[model samples]
Target: MEGIAIKLNKNISLSLLALIFFLIGLFSIYTEVFSGIDRMILDYKFRHLQQEDSNKKIVLVSIDEKSLSYFNSNGMYWPWPREFYQIVTDYFHESGAELIVYDILFDTPDFDRRNLSGTMSDRRFLQSLKRSNNAILAFKSTENEDPAVDLSMNNEPLIEHYNIKNDPPYKEPHLLTSKPLDKFAKAATGLGNTVMSPDEDGLIRSIHLFDSLAYKGFVPTLSMAAFLELQPDTVSLEWTSSGLRIGDQNIPLQDNGDYLINWYEKGGVRNGTFPYYSFQAIVKSAIQKMRNPDAEVSVPPSVLEDKIIIVGASAAGLGDIKSTPISSLEPFPGMEIQATILNNLIGNNFITQPPTWIAILILLLISIGIPFVIAYSRPGKGAAAIISILFAIIGIGLALFTYERIWFSTGLYLIMATIAYSGSAAYKYFAEEKQKKEIRSAFGQYVQPEFVEQLIAQPNLLKLGGQKKRLTVLFSDIAGFTSISEEKAPEELVSFLNEYLGTMTDIIFKHSGTVDKYIGDAVMAFWGAPIDQDNHAELACRSTLKMMQKVKELAPQDTNIHSRFGIATGDMIVGNIGSYNRFNYTVLGDTVNLAARLEAANKKFGSNTMIAEKTYEDVKDVFYGRQLDFLVVKGKTKPVRVYELMGEKSDPDTEELEKIISTYQKGLDFYLNREWDKAMNRFQEVLSLKPEDGPSETYIERCKKFKEEPPPKDWDGVFHLKTK
Candidate 1:
C-alpha cells in the first residue's frame, strides 16, 4: 500500500512540474502573439483606479464649437483673424495669468496679409506676444525634414542645458523642429514643438519631450517649454542612466526619450477635468474689463489669475483628437493631452514598469507557487486558493499603481498562475483517481472503505515511516469472551464476533476514526492521524461511548457479553509498518500499551469505560467525568490519572450526575490523603445518590481494606497493577 501511494505521488508531482513549464511557455506566447490584450489590461487598471480631481490650477482657452458659433454669428470667418488671438492674449496677460501655451502651430504667415498691409494682422499678434511676459508658441517636426522658416535667437532659451546619450537608438526617429514664422517666433518668449505620436494601437499614451536636432541641439515640446518658462532659474537639467532629471525629479523614458504621459485626470472638454474658457469669451472679457474697469465680468479676472493657460482649437475640424486608454470611444483633444502632460510634470507624477528581472521573478514565483497549492488542496478548496492568489496579484498591481506610480504586467502573470492551477488540477484529478483505485484494491479488506478513501485523498499517510504525533487511541474487548467461545459452537462464535466487530467498525468510521485492527474479540482504533483532528480526544471518547451503546443493540438478551473500553491520549508513532511486500497501518509506543492496559483494568472495577489523564484534560469542559484513580498500569513507572467517560455534556440527568461526581471526588480525595474512615463514609454517601455505583463501591472496598492494613509510610496514592 505504501509503495503504491509513493509511486502515484511521484507521478502527480512530475505532471504538475511539467504543467508549470507549459504555463511559462504559454505566457511567452501570449505576450508575443496577443500583446494588445496586455494594453487592454493596463487600460482597464488605469480606469478602475482613477480618482476624482477637484483642483483646476491649469486652464484651457479653447477655440471650441461654442466660440466658433459665437464668432461666426458676429461676422467673423472660420479662420478667425490672428488679431483675435492677440486680444485673447492681452486678456489673459492683464488677468494675471502666469503662462500661455499655443497648441496651434503658426508655420506660415496669415494668408490675408496681402490685402491688409501696413501693420499686418500677424504683426498685431506678434506685437501682443512681445508685450506678454509668459507667452509660448508652437511648431512642428517631421522625419528627414527641416524647418520652412528661419531659426531665430528667441529659441535659445528652449535648448536643454545637459546632453543625453541616445543609446541603442530611440523608438522614434530624431527630427528637428520646423520653427514658426520668423517674426512671430522671435516675438514669443519661448518656442516648443506641438507634435504628437500615437501608439501602435492608435492610443496616445506617451509623448516626445525633446526633439533631438541634427545640429541645433534639443528643443522642448510645447508643454515642456511652458514648464521651463515656469522654473527658468531654479531648474537645472541633468542626464541620468534611466532618463533625464530636471532638478530632483526624474523623467522616466523609453530608449528613444519619449515619456509615458501620466494622465493625472480624466479628459472632457467641458467636464471641468481642467478649467475651460471660450477663446471668444476671454477676448470679449478683456474688452469688457478694459472698457469698464469696475464692471462685473462673467470671465472673472480672478478665474484666470495665476493660472497657466493652454490655447488650443477644440472645434471639430480645427483640433486634432486621439483615442486614449480612458477615453477609448470618445476621442481626447490633443490640447488636453498636453495639459495632462504638463500637470503630470509640474506635480512630478510618473508611471514606470518594474525592471525586467523583477517582473520575471514575479512571474516565476506565481507560476511555481500556484501548482503546488492546487496539488495539495482538495478540489473546491484548490479553486478558491487559486482565485485568492489571482486577486492578490491584481491587488499588488493596483497598490503599485496607486502609491508608487508604477505599473506591471499583472494580467499576464495572473494568466500564467491560472493556467498553471487549472492544468495541474486537471492532471492531479486523474492521477488521484488512479491512486484511489489502487488504494481500494490493496487495502479494502484491511480497512473500512471510508478510511481507504481518506488515505487516497491524502496519499502522504501511506508512507512507510512513522511520525510521533499526539493521538487518541482506544482499546475495546468483550468481557469474559473465553468462557462464551468455549461453550458456543466454533461457527457460532465466529459469527457473533464478526457481527460485534462489524457494528463497532461502522460506528468508528461514522465518526471519522481509523480502525487499526482486531485482536480476537478485541478492537483497536485511533483519532488524529491520516487527517489531523484537533479535537481528537473528544472524538475518541464520543466514539467509545457510542460503540458501547451500539454493542448492547447487537448482543442477544440471553448472553452476558458486554464490551469494556479504554481510551488514552498521548504521543505515539503512527504509520504503515511491515516489510516492503506487506504492511499494516498502525500505531506503536507507550501510549498504545497504556490504552490496552486500561481496557483490561476495566474488568477489576466492573466498569465499562476508562480513560487516561491526558484524554480527560482535553475534554474536561465538554465531557462528564470524574478522576477515578492514580494508577501505575503494567510496564510504566509514572502514575497516570484515569476516569470514566459517562457521556457528552449534553447527556440528560446531568445535574444529578454532577452531584454524584462531586461526592465521589471527595471520597477519592480522602482516600488519597490516607483518611480511610472519612473516605469510607464519603463512598457510602456516593452509593446513596446512585445505588450500585461501580467506582464508589470499588473505592469503599479499598477503604475498608486500608483501615484493616494501613498503608506503609512510603505508599503513594498510586495503585500499582500487578496484572494486565
Candidate 2:
C-alpha cells in the first residue's frame, strides 16, 4: 500500500481522478434487487406487436407506370379513378384472397372537387364497393373538427349510404370521433391509427398502435390485427410485477397508454417492410395472377401471405423518423415497428432483468475486482494493458449478459475503474516524484551528493514535522577568532572566515552528518537523521578528531584557522523544528547544549578537541582519551564528565596505561578525601606525566584552594560552570 501511495502521487491525472471518485461513489451505492427491471416491460410489448404481425401480409394493386400512363399523364397523386378501384377490387375477388386492404385514403373525392357530378368514371366505384365485401378502406385526418356534412366524389351526396343510423364512431372510425368503432368496427377486421412518435429533431419517431376498440382492452393496434386474424383457439394471460401479460408476451403500456415505441433507424425494416410497388403495379400483378392461375407469377405468395402489414411511408418527406435505442433517427410507423418488435420477441431476441440479488452481486464483483486490478498493475504500457484488459472483461461480460436477456452496468464499471486506477497511479507517481525533487533541491545544495541520494532514498529521515532522534552533535569554534580577526581588516576577516568555515562544513557533510547551524566561527552538526546512523557516535567522534587535526594543520598555515571542536552524544530532536511558518532541520536538547559547552570548554585547555562523557563512552575503546572532572554545566542538573580524545586508542602496553590510571585515580581519591596536600602531590605527578592535561592542572588549582580554606567537612568534588 505504501509503495502504491508513492506511485499514485507521482502519476495522478484528471481522467483517473474522476474515475476514482466515480468508483467511490459507485461502491457506496446499495443496489436494490430488480431495480431496473421495469424497462423489460417495454421489451415484452414490442415482441407482442411482432407476434401480431407474424400471420399478416399486404396485397398491393400498385398504380404502376402501366396503369398510371393509361389513366392519365400525371401518373399518381390525386384523382384515383373510381373505375380503377373497380378493377382492383374485381381482381382480388376473382382470386381466393382472404382480405383486401386499401393503403390510399379516399378523403376528398377528385370527381366532387372537379365538379363532375354525373361523370361515368365516378359511378363505377359503386359496383366495386358492393362486390368487395372483405375489403378494408383507409381514411386520413384533415385536422378539421367540424362534423356538419359528408363530402363524396365530385359534387352531390352529403348522406351516408352505408347506413350509419345505429352505428358508433368506429363504424366508420373518423379521426374526429373519440370512441372506437364498437358495432361498426366489428364489421371490419381491425382499425389502426397512423400516429407516430417524434424523434428529438421533430421527425416521427414511432407508430403508436392505436386500436379502435370499443374499449382499450383490445390491446395495441398491431396486436388487435393479429387477434382478429388468428382468433387463437384459446387466449390466456400471465401477470408480472410490471403488468398483465398475454401468455408469455407482455404488452408495454405507459401510465397514459404508450407502446414504448423507441425509434430505430429507418432502414431497420428493409427485410420486407418497404413500400409495395406503387398502386399501379399491383393491378398488373393481380391481372397476371388472375389470367394464369396455375403459372408462377412475378408476385410471391408470401408477399400477401399471413404477414399484419401496415402500409405507411417511413421515408423522410413522409416524416417517420423516431428516436430509438440504436440511434436517434426517424423510425418506422408504430404499427409496423410493433410488428417487428413482436416478431423479434417471439423469436427470443430479447433481454430481461435479473433478480435484485444478482444485480447486487454483479456490482460487488465489479467494485472489488476492478480496484485490485488497478492496484496490482504496473506503470507504463503494462498498466495500460491491464486497464484495457479489465475494461474488456467487464465490457464483454456486459455484452454477453445483454445478449442473454440481462442488462449489466458495463459503462459504469468501465468509467469508474478506469478513473480509479488511473487516478491513484497518477497521484502516487506525481507525489513521490515531487518529494524526490524536493529532496534533491533541499539537501542537494548543502549536503554531499551521496548524502543527497540517501536523503532522497529515504525522505522520512527529514520529516515535514519534527521528531526526536538520538544523534551525535558536534560544535566547533575558531580558537581566538576575534583576536585573529583584529589582526586583519573586517573585509579580509569575513573572506577568511567564509573560506575556512565553508571548508570545515564540507568535511562535516563528508562524514554523513548534517551541518545543523553556524554561529560566527563555531559550527554545529549532527548525525543519525535525514537517514539513520546507529554508529553516529563513532562517526561524529571521528569527525571531531579529524576536524581538530585539520585545524592544527591549518592553524600554522594560516593563523586564522585554528578552532576548538565539541562533540556530544545523546537523545535530541533531529528533524525539522520551528513554528509551522518557519522551521529548521536542526537538533535541540540538553545534549545539544552540552556540545556547545564542550566547544567553549576547549578554551580552558590549550587542546583543540573536547568531548563530553557520553561521547567518550562511545569511542573510548577506539580512541585514546583522558577523563576529566565533573562539572554541572548551565542548562543541566547532573554534572557531566568531559574527556579529551587524543587519537586512536587501540590496545597499549599495560605499563603506560596503569601509570596514567594510577596517577589519575590517586588525584581523584585525595581530592574527594579533602586531602589537599596529597591531592596536589598526585595532580603534580599526573601533570608531570602528561604536561598539557587540562583536568590535572584544574585539579591542582582546586587542591590549592582547599588548602587555603580547609573548612567544609561534607564537601565532595563537584564543579559548576558559569557558561552553558
Candidate 3:
C-alpha cells in the first residue's frame, strides 16, 4: 500500500510538470517568436531544393558596370539619350521579339531639349514604341497625386467589365503619379506599375498585379500588362470568392491582391541562371547596324526571336539591387526579380500559404505532444523522442515543399518541440534539487553534514531503527545561565541566547559534530553514528575546548560568560528516537546520561570543561588535560573517571599551564590521601602560581572543609553530587 501511494505521487508530480511546460510552449508559439525563425528555415529549404530552369521566353538586358564603362568611354554618362532606347527597341521589334518591356521609366522630357537633325530623341523613342505595337512602358504611382494624363481616355473595357466601386482592387491606391509625354503615353501599348512590394524581411518575394488609379479605375503591373497585350481582345475582369479572374485564367490573389512570385533560379552565380545582355553593347551594335548593314554585333540578333526583353539596370551604382532568399549579402538585380515574376505568371509556379487554422493546429499539437512525450519517457529516452519528432516534422515539411510547392512552417514546430522537451528536463532537475534542499533543511542540524548529503542521495537511510556503535557524545551549557537570564528582559535574553547558540552551532558543524538537541541553554551533540568518524572522541573534546575559548572572547563587560562541557565515548544506540510524527536523531545509553551529569558537575568543580576517562584516553596524546577526580554521577552506578580539558598540546602557554597543573595535581593527591594541612598548602601554592584559577581556589576550600570535619578512614576518592 505504501509503495502504491509513492508511485501515485510520482505520477501526479510528473503531470503537473508536463502541464507547465505545455503552457510555456503555447505562449511562445502564440507570440510568433517562431515566425521569423520559420521564415529563415524556409529560406534554407528553398536554397537546397532542386533548382528550376529559367523561363526560355524571357531575357534581361542589364545596364551593368560593363555597359556603364563602355558608355562612359564614349564620352556619354548614364540616362543616355533616348535615342539609345529607341534604337534598341527598334532592333528588338525588327528581330521578331514579341514584347519589349522597359523597367526604366521615361517620366520626364530629355534635359538637353535640343532636337538633333530631324527630331527630338523623345519623339523618336515614342515612334519606336508605336512601331513595335507590343512595347510595355513601366511607371510608378503615388497616393498623393494623380498622373497628369487625359483621364477621359479610358480603357473602357477594364472599367465596364467589373463595376465594383471603391473596392481595394479598384480604388484610391498608388495612382500613376508620373508619366512620359501625353503623346508618348497615348501611343504606347499599355502603362504598367513597376512597384514590387517586399516582405518585412526585405526580400521581394511577390508583386501586386495592379495599382488602382483614382480617376481611371486601375492600371496593370508590367507582367500583367504584357500578358494583356498577348490577348487579341479586351479580357473580362471577374472577382469571385476564390480570387480574381482575367479572361479564362483564374488568378489566385493573396489577401492584398498580390501574387506570390515563384523564384525560378538563384542569383550571384557564374552565368547566373538567366541570359543577360549588356545594354550598351546592344545599343552600340544596333547603332553600328543602322550605320552599316553588315556590322558584327556582340550578340546574334536571332537570340531575341519571339523573346520578351526586360530593360533594367544591374549596376550597384544604379541602386537597383534587391535582397532575395537566393542571395542575402549580394543583392539580386530588380530586373531579374521582375523577370522571375513574369516567368511565374507563365509557368503558374505560384506558392500558396496554408490557412491560419492549419498553423494554429500544428502549433497546438507540438506544444502539447512534445512535453507529454518527454515528460513521460525515461530520462535518456526523452531525447530520442525529441529527435524522432524533429525529423518527422522536417520530413513532412520537405515533402510538402517538394511535391506540392507548399511551404509549411516546420521551424516553429521544431523549436517548440525542443523548447518544451528542454523545459521539462530542466523542471525535473530543479524539482529533484528542491526535494534534496527540503531534506537538508529538515535534518541538517540533527545529522552530520556528510550524512545529510548522503540522505539526499539515498533517502531510505533515514528510518527509525538504529545500530549500536561506540560513539562520542557531548553536552555543553552556559555555567551561569540562570543568573544571566534573570538580569535581562525576555527580548534581550532571546537575542543573547540566539547569538551565543548560533556561534556555538557553527563551531560544532565545523568539527563534524551532530547537534542532537538544544535543551534550554544546554546543547547535546554526538558523532560517529550518522557519519562514521574514527576520531569522534578527539573531535568532541576539541570542540568543547574551542567553545570555552570562544565564550571568553564574547565575554560581556559587566559580567563574564563561560561554557561548561562534558564529553564521553562509549557504546550507544543512535538514530531517530521519539514518536513517529515528531522524532529526532540522538544518542541513548549510560554514556549520554553520564555526559549530561558531567556538564552539570562543572557547577561543583569550578571547571570550564570536563571529559570522561574514556574521552581523555582517546585524546590524551594530542591534548593537554588535568585528571580531576572520580565521580559517581546521578543515575549512574559505576564511578566514571573525569578530567578537566584545558587545551591542545600545541597551545602557546602549555609549558606554564602544565606547571600549574602539576601543582594542582599534587594538591589533589594530598587531598585524596586525607592530608589536610599539606593539601591546603599545596592548593595555596597552586593559587599563588595562577591566582585567578578556579580549580585551585575550589580545592583550597575543599581542603579547609576536610580539615574542619574529616571523613572516615575508609572514605573512597569518588565524589557524589547531591543535585543533577
Candidate 4:
C-alpha cells in the first residue's frame, strides 16, 4: 500500500513538472522570448556558410568614398547634376545592359544652379531614360497620407505599366506613396518602391515583393521591377499557404507577408564578389567615350553588357548601411540588399521556415519526453541522454538550414529539454532521495527491519516533519510496579522488566503498531503513522487485550502481575520531536495526553484495559467493550466517555461478559438519575452474576455514598479523577 502511494505521488509530481515546462516552451515560442539567441545562432551560421562567389549577372555601381571624393575634387559636390546620371545611363544603354535599377529615391526634382536652364538637366536625364528603355526608378512607400501630391496626372500610366494581378492580396495597402517628380517618373521605364523595414533588432532580413497602394493598385519592389522588366510576359501573382507564386517561380514568405532574403557573399567596390565599378569610374568612361567615341576608358563596356546594373550610395554618410545576418560589425549597403533580392528571384533561392504547428509538435515531444527520460533512468544515464538530445536537435537544425534552407527553432527546443531534465533531476534528489534517507534514519529501530525497508522504498508514506493525523495511541503500565521493584533485587528487577517489556512490545508489533517509547515499567505505542491504516483503532485495541492476556500468562504463580492499558483515537501531531542532537519519533497533543491519563485512570476503575470513546466507536463492531465512565482526568477540563475493552466479539467468554455489562450499564443509568435504591439493586445483581467484578462493587459503594449525600442537581455523571 505504501509503495503504491509513493509511486503515484512520484508520477504525479513528475508529470506536473513536465507540464509546467511544456507551457513555458509554448509561451517562449509564441512571444519570441529567446529570439535574440536564435538570431545570434543564425548569424553564426551565416558567417560560417557564406558563399565564396556572388551572382555574375548583377553589377554594383557604388557611389563610395573614392567616387564622392573624386567628384568633390572635380567641383561636383554631393547630389551631382542629373545630367551626370544621364551620361551614365546612356553609357549603360549603349553597352547593352539588360536593366539599370537605381536604388536612390529621386523624389524631389533636380535643380542645378550652375546650369543656365535648371530644367534642362531633368530633361536630359529623362531623355537618357527614354532612350535606354530599361531604367527602373526607385520610390518610397509611406504610411502618412499626402493630399498635396497630385494623383491625376500620371496615376493611370504608372498603374498600367507597373501593376500586376494580385489574386487574393497578401499584404495591407500602403495609403500613400512618395515618388520622383512627374517628369522623371513618367520618363522611367518602370518604378519600384525601396521600402526596407528592419526587425525590432534593427537587422534587415526580409522584404515585401509587392505592396498594394490606395489609388495606384500593386507596386512591385525594385528587385521585382527589374525581374518584370527582364520578363515582360509575366503577369499574375498569387498567395499560397506557404508563400507567394509569381509566374513559374515560388517565393517563401514569413507570416507577416515578407520574403526572407538568402544573402550571398558580401560584394561592393571594396570586394570582388560582384563586378563592382565606382560611380566616378563609370562617369569617366562615359566622358572618354564622348570625347572620341573609341577612346580607351578605365571601365570597359563589356563589364556592363547584358548585366543588371544597381546604382546606389555606399558611403557611410549616405545613411544606407544596414545590419544583415551575415555581418553587423561591418554592415551591408542598402543597394546590395536590393541586388541580393534580385539574385534570389533570378536563382529561385530563398530561406523558408516550417509551419508553427510543426514547431509546436516538436516542442511538445521534447517537453514531455525528456522529463520521463530523466525521471526513470539513473542520474548518469539521464544526463547522457539529455546531452544526446541537445546535440541531435542542434545537428538536425543545422543540417536543414545548410542543405534545405529550412530554419527551425532549435533554441526553443534546447531550452525546454534542459529545463525538463534539470527540474526532474532536482525533484528526485530533493524530494524522493532525501525523504528515503529521513525515513531510514528515523524508523530504523522503532519498526521491524522489513518494515523499515518497505518505508525506505516508499518514503512518501511518512511526512518527516510534524503533521496532524488521526491515529490511535496506547499507554500501558504494570500495576503496583514500584512495590514490585522494591521487593526484588536489582538484577531480578531488571530481568523481570526486560521480560515484561519485551513480551508487550512483541504483542504491539504483531498488530502493526509502533512502540513510541518505554518509561521504566510503562510502554507507549501508536498505530496509523509513518503509514496509513484504516482500522488503526481496532489494531490498538487488539494489541491492548493481547498485552493484558500475555501479562497474566507470563507472571509467576504466587505473584500477582497485571498491566493496565489506555487507548485513544484522535487528531494528533506525530513526528520527530526534541532537540536536534537527540530526537524521538513520537506522537503529541491532547490525544496522547488523554491516553496516558486513561492508563492511570484504570487503577481507579480496577479495569485492565480502557479506551476513549473515539477508539471504542471505531472498533465497536469487532470488539466487545462496555462504557466505563465520562472521565475528566487530571489537568483536563473536558470530559471524555471511556470504555473498558473486555475481549473480541469472537471470544468464548463474550456472551457472559455482555450479560454482566448490560446489568452494570443499567445500574450506572439509575445511579446517574439519583435513584439510589434502583441503582443499588442492579449493582447487587451484577455482583451476584460476577462476584469478582470490581466496577459493580465500586458502583454499589458509589450509590450508598450518593444516597447519604446526594450529588448536586447539575451533576452530569462525569467522573473526575484527581490524581495522575
lDDT by residue (tens digit), candidate 1, 349-457 = 7778776667667766766666677777788898998889888988888888887878777767666776677777776788778878877875675455777778786
Q: Pick the candidate with the highest lDDT.
A: 4
Error of 1 at 504 (Å): 22
The digit string of per-residue lDDT tens for model 2 on 39-66 reads: 3333333333222223234332333344
For each candidate, the alpha-carbon lDDT, in order, equals 0.78, 0.55, 0.76, 0.81
Estimate, for each residue in 9-59, the C-alpha lDDT of model 3 and write its tens digit: 766766666566556656665676676787787777767774575458888
What TM-score, over all chains together, does every model reach? 0.59, 0.56, 0.55, 0.62
List candidate 2 segments past 4 Å from native: 1-340, 343-409, 412-441, 457-461, 556-561, 649-691, 706-713
* Model 4 CA deviation exceeding 4 Å by range: 1-9, 52-54, 144-172, 175-177, 446-724
Worst 10 residues of 2 by lDDT: 155-164
Report the lDDT of model 4 for residue 697.
Answer: 75
Best by TM-score: 4
Off by over 4 Å in 1: 1-38, 52-55, 113-119, 143-171, 176-179, 214-216, 233-235, 254-258, 290-294, 328-331, 352-357, 399-406, 440-455, 458-461, 465-724
Write the residue-wise lDDT of candidate 4 on 33-130 in tens digits: 98777777777777666654435899989888899999889787888788889999999999989999999877677775664355788888889999
Clashes by residue pair, model 4: none
By lDDT rank, best first, the candidates go 4, 1, 3, 2
Give per-residue lDDT, candidate 4, residue 570. Answer: 98
C-alpha RMSD (angstroms) for model 3: 12.4
